[model samples]
Target: MSMRVLKSTGAAFVMQNMRTCVNKPIYKETFDVNSLKKICDMLVVSAQQRKLVRLAICPQVTQHQIWTGALMEILNQLEIEMCVKDCMKGSNMAQQIVVNCLRFLDDVVSYDPDSTSWMRVAPKKDADSSPSAKWSDLLEMFNDLINCLKNDHEFLFYVIKLEIMKEGLSQIKDVLVDKNIGYKEALHQQSLVHKKLTKSLGHSSRCLFTLLLYYLYGSIQDIELDICWYSEDVSGNKLYLCVGKIIASDEDKMLMHIFKQLDRALGVIKFVHEMAEMKEILEIQGHLWCIGSKNRSFAYRGHNFFIHGISLE
Candidate 1:
């Protein structure tokens, strides 16, 4: 097919055809570096346009020496430096291309050749041998790409921020919250923060709150919830507060002040409601300490709890 035809056909169709072609020995023999480069160029453009393209090059493809050599050559010619420069200039398209390329290389290098189905054909003894030359080359190429990307300070900052946002999002579901309501609420908040971070480098108040939660109380299993009614404020408003304390670690001591600020910024009622939802969901027992005023009315997991002046010391 002509290059124009391939481009118009889109990544999904081309990727499927490439996968099928790889299975044929003649296709492998005839595939040259220029052809592979063209295919990759198409993929980069598609990905830049935010289209998903299942990677054609993977561990299974690398099993063939010819394909591996072609991949190495294409990787060598990758315009990673130019792409990163564009990324530093605030080009989201360039950023997407760079991230996709890095992730693609990461997938290739992290794959275990032994896990491939073709490995079953080889004897166990042969499969257990040291890493093959192709694997070594892929690893070297991945490292080179990383080194190149890291050379640009601004690009490296952007990459680190993206990774932090990813980690924060992944852990949001694991947060100890009510399955019915708190889960959705927490997810929405986290998603908003992620969206803001993606468009700009600035951190919003919600971003600070998110980073604090994930950084300090990320593991719900080891967290302790302390809820209490402090003295009435000057305006005669009763203060009900909930504080998250790390039960098993001393790391909280150093950042205790910062955590307090972040928690307080969310206000007492909202904070207590959030913590109560989590406490009920996780069925956390014995770690909860309630103090101060009796006859304080508060809401916990959609239930009204009227507690007399009782302290759980």
Candidate 2:
């Protein structure tokens, strides 16, 4: 099928499916702590849970159909699973982990908050001559890749993905251990970030950080790459971006860029702090881990950003 045709049909099919399953239960009626624990146990020891999540969040599926149900279901299961075995086993913490999982899907989906991004898909009207759009070809290539992965039982990506997940769960433990109010406050403020990404209430920065942590844990095959952070805070009503890495030929350039971004971020933090009255905010400082590399001085110059009241954690 042509790429445009596939796009059109795939979209239509997805819309139809969304309408159909919009009401279908994505999860079991009641949250079973045991079943959730089972999933988590399997997840900790096996990589299949990560694979299911990665496939479920694939752009092709998420863009077409609303998989909130599937997500909720899996999340509910995981929460149940983790609570029994781990000290973090409570309705509150369980829900937090599950909600964090949803944010992963948020990044992969075609999200137009204002519904004005349709032009990204529509072919340009100024086509003078028939230029065969590469989109169709790309889609075909992706489809072929998916088929090959399925046929050959390729599972390397999810292997990395699972490693990241373990990191996320570990963060939960870390959050519990940290006793500073600033750390707790930042964690509380992160709830807003969670809401922005998932549009779900009562969940925030902890989830975004969890996602960041998981991605950071997951490694790129054979490449010493940097981290990418997309985090937010709604209570503080601020957004944070750590898009990819700064490509620099020398430390001086990298330090300069990092300082520049931090200076701008500090400005943003100050503005947010002044604009609100006793508002909650998330303070995040992101620095790429360059361990096991040359000249890994473990310094990125500036490494802090604030939303409400900035504090080093």
Candidate 3:
């Protein structure tokens, strides 16, 4: 079929199928990966032609010709299976599939939040040219792309990591470990409680950092080359504070394990502290670890103090 004919017919078919699915439960399941791929493929082609698929897909709409939420769920599942599990990482068409799926997601999610779902049925216009014209939903789409693309290349991972940090930090800064949580007890308490509290509040940065930490900490055997890429924003501060806390608290095994995984990236932490002008704070924290190393002497205000020293001064 000519691309134009396919785009028109495919969009019409999707609308009709979506309408039928509203009344029939079986039709809901019918919009599986293959069905979604067909729709997404047509949307991708249409996008190339500067014609986006604009159908009402939100909850309040009466016609209910599309279910964007369900569509996103399917995409999430396929993403996990294909990208996360690396099942289709080697497939020739996997990248295209991912690109189309994400493009369609951006399309549906790009609907003006202020507009009613019914308004989505309007004819396509200049607003549909870019997949991310409406940036309110940008991260929701970018996150999936990041997860899908990160494992593919270090430079790509670095790029997406920076973007995520910018967006995630701006929108969900509270879920971030407080930069002041530099003390061991504070860090420990925060780690134990932040996950549950953040989940209850419907935030994501906590989970994102927790998972990233898990990956970094667990990579004791084969750390990636771009491990240093995480040394900025949410990841960098959280980790720096985390390491300082762990070291201060005498988490000997964990400290050693994390250090091993971090390898040479430890320098990045130093650089990060320098950039933040928190070098003095890092030096002070370093003393917590040095307490066990050896005796040290320092003179302060005409008084001499030594490591493990007891003095009235």
Best by TM-score: 3
Clash count per candidate: 2, 14, 0
RMSD of each: 28.7, 25.8, 27.2
Model 1 earns a TM-score of 0.19
User: Which residue runs does candidate 3 get wrong by more than 4 Å?
Assistant: 1-256, 261-266, 276-313
lDDT of 1 by residue, 113-210 (tens): 44333323332335566632222333333444445555466556333333333333233323222112233443444344334333332222222223
Q: Candidate 1: where is the Cα deviation over 4 Å?
A: 1-84, 87-146, 162-273, 276-313
By lDDT, the best candidate is 3
Q: For model 3, name the residue pairs that clash.
A: none
Higher-TM-score candidate of 1 and 3: 3
TM-score of 2: 0.18
Clashing pairs in 1: 294-308, 294-309
